[model samples]
Target chain A: MKIMPCPLNGPRNISEFVHGGEVRDMPNPTTCTDREWAEYVFYSDNQAGIVTEWWLHAASGYWFIAERHTVTDEIIRTYDPSEIFNQRVEFSDETTAKEVGA
Target chain B: MSATSPESLSKRSFVYRQLAGASFRDIAGGAMATGVAEGNNNRSQAEQSALLDLSVLPRTGFRGLTAAAHLQAAGLPIPARPNQASVTGSGELVLRLSQKEFWLLGALSDSGAGVDALNQRGLPAADCYSLYCQDSHAWLALTGAHLPATLAKVCGVDLREASFPLGSIAQTSVARVNVVIVHHQLAGVPCFSILCDSAAAEYLWESLLDAMGEFGGEVIGSNALL
Candidate 1:
């Protein structure tokens, strides 16, 4: 089997990944209704072209979005959903500005 | 960490805190060429009877009371492989889940005899990515009311039974030693049987001791943890 780089899991051998149908776009769940919601949740585009999809990095225990060409598992780009949500939090442990001023 | 039920979700009863930084030891597939081998045999058969201490046994090793052992299902995680089921033999239990795999439970010492039986039945060792994991290395199942809390100090996995359930098993680093977390519970208490690199045992033991302090747990040697 030929080895290729996957966005996640660093450099795992190609054999480890199974071709999960065509990766496609997802509609916003909050705004969608009825068939649109059903389609968004239950259907797959399964097309053969540049597409953005969700891939399960089974070995590495990560799930992320990938932009790739359907015909070739050649991924165009990858982004970590967790990283996007990982904004730095600043906690206010102890210090009240009003009290200090007064 | 929630204030009221911090222990439930903080993942830090003690040893469970390492879940974030732990390098998971993947127990799937066959073991490396060089792995843990304590000794092939211990001469005293009489001692063999008492060699194992089941008090600390995980739900998996507690399996000793039962005649059942593991039946390996190697090369099975293959996507297209169908009808692959999980069961046990008299030696060891091996199974695959999602993209991961596990070694059910077995007696490390008596493993060869079990493998010999499988070989006698015409199944070759090379048939699948199979190893009598019991013979593959030294394993200790640290199960108790405070097991997950005790293990948190040295391990990195989230040992919550809700997340890492009884069937869950993974090969990951503990106390910096490579090990497989064999998920097993005892009387509703979550526990793990850790498999490690043989030479790394001392480090793991010390780590376990350091983590077990808060629970008023005393240090137990391998003989005790057995």
Candidate 2:
């Protein structure tokens, strides 16, 4: 049984988690070109070595970040999304005011 | 004495249809199974190994960036960290599922007063929103000495008393169904309160019973827990 360590709940069966796409910086939807937005939404680097990705613990509905080896499929480490998402990303046509974490 | 029939109640358990031969009682405007036809000693059976449906019991959840603060402001004792639980003076169990998500389960004796009071107070803060736990999930209590072993057949978590001690909570898959398992006690009997999607309640209940058949597990009622 493959195990996925959840930042919120402890390690659990891999079956309990859904592999969200690779984590990437979002291009401001209001400013970026439609092609840029499409690439961001529909493409993945699919790196071969260590890569950061999004994972969702289905039971708790908690999403977190995990670093794993693409070749070995070994989970290197797992941590809460707050580690990287310190600011709330806001996309607006009038103003793209992002709220930085206090 | 005759008990209330589930058909007469406006609110019924999600698995009420599977409770044939069990006597029912009124609880928080809903029908709760109080006893089974063959279980002459349900209390003892609960002490050994039994499954009790608590779907009609009062339970509410709150989630948001400020949900914990909101609950604490309401005078409820929130757990210091996620995946932990605290019992209130009135016997209500407060479970902190995440940094901002908390679930409040009313004590059996209180029916629904504790949760009702909190719900009535409303979400006075922005971002803090009330969750429809009562309508969205079905609660089941798996109690007794053989709980860990029986659960082992279906769950992957280390639910042994030593590993998953009292007050610990695990949100994981059980019998391939998503469930939140809270380790607590009811009337001094160790219990794992399993909460799952209401739509899958009957399926999960049946699966649990099938897994527990080897241990002489029996169906119990809420009265046994009280």
Q: What tens-digit string does per-residue lDDT give for candidate 1 at A1-102?
A: 444344533443444444444344445443446699667667777778888766664433346666788798577876665544455444342324533653
Error of 2 at A52 (Å): 1.2
lDDT per residue as tens, model 2, B60-93: 9999998988788889998999999999988899
Predictions in order: lDDT: 0.41, 0.89
How big is the positional error of residue B41 in model 2, measured in Å on the Cα after superposition? 4.5
Error of 1 at B74 (Å): 12
Alpha carbon lDDT at B113, candidate 2:
88
- In candidate 2, position B53 carries an lDDT of 89
Compared with the true structure, the alpha-carbon lDDT of candidate 1 equals 0.41
- Model 2 ranges off by over 4 Å: A95-102, B1-3
